[model samples]
Target: MIELENLSYTYGGGELLSDVSLRLQPGSFHFLTGPSGAGKTTILKLCYGALLPTTGRLSVFKQDIARLDRDQLALMRRRIGVVHQDCQFLDHMTLAENVALPLTVSGQIDTAQREDLSELLSWVGLGTRLDSHPPELSGGERQRAALARAVILSPDVVLADEPTGNVDWEMSQRLLRLLVELNKMGKTVLIATHDMSLIRAAKSQVQARVLRISQRQVQLAGADL
Candidate 1:
């Protein structure tokens, strides 16, 4: 549902990404891998309209990002969920309130949504931690809570950046399985990570396309991965 054609992003007089083209189809799963500073996060930002391309075209759900107005862009973003590398939560809010922020902002919070919120937290294994504050959560718990919040709207696409970076292997696998389950439910999934083992582990359970960024270009990773 997201496509980038010959896209390039420049920052501070240098190009971070150059002539990159990729499409995320419905129900597709993709892993974006590269060295640090290779613009993996930039690609994710471009996909979700957080940053516009310096050159070329980016379309989300068939609408050109450059042509969209501020309100239109805001509306379009609701259909795409993002799990940032740093899972930031309001320290003053309860986990439930934090996860339910989107619904509250959209004026969609109600009894049924509250029920769904509980189920979502439970799905992320945070059902019993509803009243806990962000500072009380561990790294893995924070990541899972972030995922729960990202998908709380049941968005059509989910983009995650280094989601398992701070967790242990077991917790990483747990997060991977949660993401895999989301893919099975037909949500488009794109993850940018440096963890090769995690990508290898996902191969058996999901058909994933691994894309590598090298020398300012995007290429499909070789079988060695």
Candidate 2:
């Protein structure tokens, strides 16, 4: 779980986020929406310990992020999976190797884990693409593969930033369903996106709290959403 208390983040002498408070509970689903440059990505970074609050407090799993040392922060990050907006991958690595990077880095990769890796890729509809490289994948394939990579470690929380930004409506819905499935499995989910239609589509399938960023603050969206 992640909690932010009266948090503010300043960059380049400007305050991008101010007085934002949020608590991500276990098994919860949330959608963060706002226009471009609204600090949606900034908030996700704070939640996963990628960036510390410039003022106020941020805690991941009950420990203040500002107080954690490097090693501790690294260990804490393993509990939070993130799907970046860019869907970055090593061009030289195979899909299976890319998805298994987390396990490899954490010293958890082995024969049994490789079998599980195949299952994970299969879950993302990439079972047959394991031998392919990043350049060989289509847009939707890359997004789904990114999701697979993010959850490969079985993180307690999953944060995705504009996950469907590059895909078509059908593929977007597919990714949404995959995320919904993860929520059903009891993983905490927070997705930052500008797509209102996607958020609307998710509401019927799952109970999701829509949080909108406006004027440097975060507030729960009303029924209009």
Candidate 3:
């Protein structure tokens, strides 16, 4: 559903990424692994149309992102859910509100689907914390809440950057399970993480291809783990 053709991005005499090309097919799951400053996050941003490439083309859901206007890009993103390494939430809103913000922003609200939101929160183990503020929750709880929010709109593709960066091993595994389940249900999943152990854990549960950002490009990662 996402394709990058000879994509390259440069800034202030530095090349964050170059000659990167890949295709993320529908229902495919991928783990992006790289060291710090290796452009893992940059790639995720490109996939979701956050930053336009300095050269080459990026297509999502068959639309060329390079030619889209701001409004068009915003509409395009509605089909792709993104989870950042640092969760973004309104400090004043309750966890439930935060999770439902996507629906609000999309100008979509079905009173009958209120139960769907509750069920999502419950799936992420945040049902009891629905009324809790962002600051009141633990790091893992916040991460799970972010995941719930990203998928609330039922995006066709999901992109997560460092999703388990702050969670414990058990929590990481739990989060992985949720992601795998999403893939099973036919959503495309792409995650950028530096944690090899987490990759290994996921490899055991699902058929996930690994991609690595190296030498200023993204390529299919070799079986090094």
Q: Alpha-carbon error at 147 in model 2, in Å?
A: 0.6
Q: Write the per-residue lDDT of candidate 2 for residues 57-134, one digit (tens) a residue.
A: 998999999999999999998988899978999999999999998888899888877678788999989989988999
Model 1 lDDT tens row, 36-64: 99999999999888899999999999999
* Cα distance off (Å), candidate 1, residue 211: 0.2
Q: Which residue segments of model 3 deviate by more than 4 Å? A: 223-225
Q: For candidate 2, what is the total of clashing residue pairs?
A: 0
Ranking by lDDT: 2, 1, 3
Per residue, candidate 3 scores C-alpha lDDT tens digits across 1-225 of: 999999899978898888889999999999998999899888999888888899998999999998899999998888888998889999999888899988888889768766787899999998788789999998899889999998998999999999999999999999999999989989999999999999999877889999988899887888633
Residue pairs in clash, model 2: none
Identify the candidate with maximal TM-score: 2
* Clashing pairs in model 3, backbone N/Cα/C closer than 3 A: none
lDDT (Cα, 0-100) at 193 in candidate 1:
98
